[model samples]
Target: MLSKFYGEIFAILTSVCWAISALSFEIAGKKIGSLPMNLIRMSLALIFISIFSVFYNGNIIPQGANSEQLLYLVASGLVGFVIGDMLLFHSFVLIGARLGTLMMTMVAPISAIISWFALKEKMSLWQIFAMLVTIAGIFIVIYSRNKNHKKIEAKTKKASILFLGFLLAFGGAIGQAGGLVLSKKGVLNYDAFSASHIRIITGFLGYILIISFTRLWKKVFAGLKNTSALKTVSFGSFLGPFLGMSFSLIAVKNTSTGIAATLTSLAPVIIIIPAIFINKEKVSFLEILGAFIAVIGVALFFI
Candidate 1:
């Protein structure tokens, strides 16, 4: 019973962690460029996760990871960390921070649906309706409330790269969905901590491969001098991959993947409070309505 309660708490915290990571990366990406920022931030996450893994598990390598499990972890890392985050970061560079974040909110449903079909998990009729309502709420929230659609007009004036960013975010979503399912499958026979370690190691290798091919090694090292970026990314890593992601795995261990994914999707709403205070973004009536509707949908999911 305690573990279940902890799982629910952690699932919610995962959304908050995601919001923090998104907010931090948006700031860092503004200065360092998305590509460099992606590599640097992910490396920080890898380092943080690795250290935690070592201290907690007494080893740096993946425990009980066979050849097949290693391959799955590597693939998961490549798709999620290397591909997903890179594209999402690029999106932040293309579109303004808010819109990019709005787009990312879609990932949860995408992941939930994919996990459902992949895992052959069953959902109740209410759960399906709730999922639909949640997705509708996302659309409502992202729908421009500007009298003249200022957000869209502004985006049109910016680089066309925002579309690419959306595509990349979508790719990242698929990768993440796949990673979750694969991790669930592989981790069944191992400790969750060790399983997470395997994932981070593979993710580290994926970033390394990208850095080599893109010739971004020099800039990455130079960017290391930017103490501010390092701090942000390091803090984000601690919240995100180390604590947030670990808890997500624990959530999946306790609940259906679809339910867990939906619950975690609440990050976007959690983000609104910060956006208002820090970024000084205005909240529209529609957005407020969407938030309430989404919250109701979340409640229905657990009914």
Candidate 2:
């Protein structure tokens, strides 16, 4: 019985891990800025993953990964880790982790759509409806109305910042969705942990290039000296890239990409209570309702 739902279980675990890491990254990013924090996070995560790979795969590097596998997995890393997470960490700085993670709920539907085209994955009409329902839930959380039902004005600088943050989050969703499809293609029948190592290796290299070209070594070095932020980033890296991402690959390998993605997208819902308590963010009733509705929509994928 447990074997049958292995993919789903791992995906749910991934959500929990991501929720914690999202809050950690948010706190750290605010202090060190997104770019430097990302480089450091990837670096720490690479160390953690390398150690795990040594124990599990008997090597620090992924063994037996062919050129085709390397191609797709490398693309997944560049898109998901380098591009997607860069945008996401910045969004967390501007919008807070709760709202930023809420926006990431879009990853489910986006991944499904991308998988359809890229991996020949098919979705039924019911699944399509579920996707729409998920989008509606996200819309409810992000958009607000006045007492008279008027839309909020975008004139304020705060509003503008929020808009940009949400846009960045959306771009992250697209990158992550594309990455999921590519990971599915690359990791079929491959060792999930080893596959994760490959993705992280590429992502680490990508960030190295980005930091070098942008000449952000000073910022990166500064981030290292901030003990508080460094602790947070290190913890987030352990939860995120080392564990959460490896579990996600296992999920996609074990089940349909759509289902796996939907389950993993539960981070928003999982993070709500922690966001309220740990992050000390005020949670409105509407936000709670919207999260539940979104979860309901995600649940429909199982049926």
Note each model's CA RMSD in angstroms: 3.1, 3.5
TM-score of 2: 0.86
lDDT of 2: 0.82
Q: Which lDDT values do the candidates have, in the order given?
A: 0.70, 0.82
Residue pairs in candidate 1 whose N, alpha carbon or C atoms collide under 3 angstroms: none
The reply for model 1, stretches above 4 Å from the true place, is 1-8, 90-105, 145-166, 278-280
lDDT of 2 by residue, 53-142 (tens): 788868987899889998999999999888988788778767655566666767878898788887888878887787677666655554
Q: Could you tell me which 10 consecutive residues in candidate 1 have the lowest summed lDDT?
A: 144-153
Can you give the TM-score per candidate against the true fold? 0.85, 0.86
- Tens-digit lDDT string for candidate 1 (79-158): 76667766665565555445565665566666667767877777788877887787667657766443355456564764
Best by lDDT: 2
